[model samples]
Target: MDALIATVKDNDLVVAFALVGLVMGVAILISKFLTRGKFQASAIAIILGLVLAYVGGVATGGEDGLADISLFSGIGLMGGGMLINLAIVATGFGASFDEMKKSGLGGIIALVLGVVLSFVIGAVIAWFFGYRDPIDLTTIGAGTATYIVGPVTGAALGAGSGVIALSVGAGLVKSVLTMVVTPFVAKYIGLNNPRSAIVFGGLLGTTSGVTAGLAATDKRLVPYGAMTSTFYTGLGLLMAPSVLFFAVKALVG
Candidate 1:
């Protein structure tokens, strides 16, 4: 038993992949049987992974979550920025250039409105919480656009770690809410077709949230949604530190 455990630990990367696959398989089965696929297996897998990571952190009393354990060290790499960027690029590859073109001005409008609205809401919340600094306000506001945008803005503007963490937390909350609420609200929001999906994705710029939400609502819409959400993220990253920061400074400082 000890020797087997050691061997698995030594091959942790492969084992991590196998474990993730198994978890995803189970998530899919449960979603199919119980929710009739309304809940989305990918979202379930994400929640499950978070739970496991929390448990790992609590059990080991370490900050790195599951990756702090010897047997699960591979998870750190699997979830790192390199693999994350690769996955984002791969998702982009799934989008059809022709369909994106069909989205036209509506898609572009959605991206602008979405980023602006989300930032406004986030900035208001920061103000309510007594965040007076322009950098902190802009960083958190950008984070609401997407988690990726939050840290990038923070780093570019030299925001403190505490403010950056709050920005990330805000984005994380938005993502989880989007994932859980998408399917239930899909019909009411008229989110059935490709054009609507693109608009919705821009409004909710988190890649995982938009894609997973679309996956739950309609698997066919994922690519369309992902494309606009990707652009929204990039736009947030660009705007937050420059225009957004200056506006906040002028308004509040």
Candidate 2:
């Protein structure tokens, strides 16, 4: 038993991947049977992962969640930025530029509106919560566009770690909300075809959430939505520090 445990620990990253696959499989099964696919498998898997992370944190009283456990330590590396970026790149490779061009002016409008609206909403929420500093507000606002944007903006602006953490949390909530709401609103929002999916992706701007949501709505639309959402993320990253931050600073500082 001791020898087996040591071997598992040594192959921690591989084990982490296996565990994630297992979770996704279970979540897919649940989506197919229990929810009839109304609740997306990705969303369910995300919820399950969060639950596991919470449980791991509670059990070990550690900040790294499941990674704090010696056996699951590889999860920290597996879920790190390198792998996440790789996944994004891989997804981008599947998208067609011609399809993106079809979205045209509508896509551009969606992207601009999405960033501005999300940032305002996030900044307002931060202000209501007593976060008066422009830097903190900008960081959290950037997070509303996407989790990746939040940290990037926060780091560039020299915001505190706590503010950066809050930004990430806000972005996660938006992602989950997007995943849960997309399917239900798909019909009303005209999210049926590729052009609309591209626009929808820009409007939401969270790659995982947009991709998973579109997957639940229509698997064919996933790539289209993901492509625009990727662009939206880049736009948010670019604007958050220079444009958005400056506007906030001018207003509050």
Candidate 3:
């Protein structure tokens, strides 16, 4: 037992992989049992992962959550932008390029609409919450677009840390909602092909949410939806702290 423990410790990355797989398997089983296939396994796993991260943070008093534990150091790398982006690219290669050609302008429209709508919604919420600063409103609004964009916009705009955290939380809620709701709405929204997938991805813009939701809807659509969804982040990063902030400022101030 000691030898095996030492071996796992020596190869912490392998342990991280194993732990993630194990947690995912458990999450899948729980999803299947609880929802009877109504809810998505990946969505359940994401929620479970978040809960565990919270618990880990409370237990360790560390800001990085689960990654703060020495044994889970590998999670930081596994979940980093590099690996996540690599996965997105890999999945994108599985997409049909011909269908992508079909989506061209519509996909661009969706991206624009998605970022605008999400940012507006977030900014509105911030306003209702009594946050009057342009920086705070923009940061939180950008967060509604996506968590990554939230912090980036906040840092660029010099927003305080508390506002940035709120922005991240807003993005997380949107991601979870997208993941949980997509499959139920897939048919009604005409999310049946690559073109719709691209539009859907653009509208939601959270890569994990759009990808996982599309995966549950149709595995083939994951790449299509995620392709536009991936661009959503970059576009959001560009728009949030600049044009969106100025617009919100003009409206409120």
Candidate 4:
């Protein structure tokens, strides 16, 4: 009982858990109102809930306090949250890809290839400039690739687990890069319609989700992505460091 109290007090797990529950409830309410029983929002709500949990958990120092937790266990929780969120969003918006048919697959493939190529190119440049840490270079490369190619490509390169620090660092870098490049790519691709914008936002969110899942030592990306707004770039920036801090702490502890 004393240990339980200490855990609660040190980590603020209660508050974090409560916040997550609240966010999930809100998501359900929103989905019900918007979809009117035709579409389920549970996946989206779950995602959002996890995001809230992570943000709240970090704010309360759960990562530092939960030092006893295994890296894989934490990552599992995080990744589960992210997958739930993705499933929800994908169910709602992935239909757009079907509409585009040939173009959709082509676009996804192109984006992936672009990201990989860009990372290779960026790594060479970083090396030429005398960057020593391969992990750091990889992070920089992944971020640059994501900006030039898209989220899929960026995530593929960024998800390397070579070093926990570099992987987390890459996540932050990718978020910044996504913010800078998403708008441009959307505009260039003629994604000006409101529907297109919504889908694009979901795609970007998914990219973040996948990267966080693969890179996070604790696997908390699912929850983080779910709680985050699909359209808000600032939210991504705010959450990236929180995720990274927790991840690094988990590694250190």
Instruction: Encode model 4's per-residue lDDT on 12-75: one tens digit a residue.
Output: 5444555456666776787688767443344445445345445545656654222223222333
* C-alpha local distance difference test of each model: 0.85, 0.86, 0.86, 0.42
Q: Write the per-residue lDDT of candidate 3 for residues 148-188, one digit (tens) a residue.
A: 99999999999999999999999988986887678779989
In model 3, pairs of residues that clash are: none
Q: Where does model 3 exceed 4 Å of error?
A: 27-47, 63-65
Q: How well does each candidate superpose onto the true structure, as a TM-score?
A: 0.82, 0.78, 0.85, 0.38
Q: lDDT winner among the candidates?
A: 3
How far in Å is the alpha carbon of 212 misplaced in model 1?
Answer: 2.6
| Global fold similarity of model 4 (TM-score) | 0.38
Could you give me the TM-score of model 2 versus the true structure? 0.78
> Considering only N, C-alpha and C atoms within 3 Å, which residue pairs clash in candidate 1?
none
Error at 137, model 3, angstroms: 1.9
Please state the error at residue 224 of candidate 4 in Å: 20
What lDDT tens digits, residue by residue, belong to model 2 across residues 1-253?
Answer: 9999988988999999999999999999999999997777876776677678778999999877788888988888987768866765676665777877878788889988999889999999999999999999999999988888999999999999999999999998998778777877899988888899988988999887887688667777887787678788889988999989999999999
Each candidate: RMSD: 2.9, 3.3, 2.6, 13.1
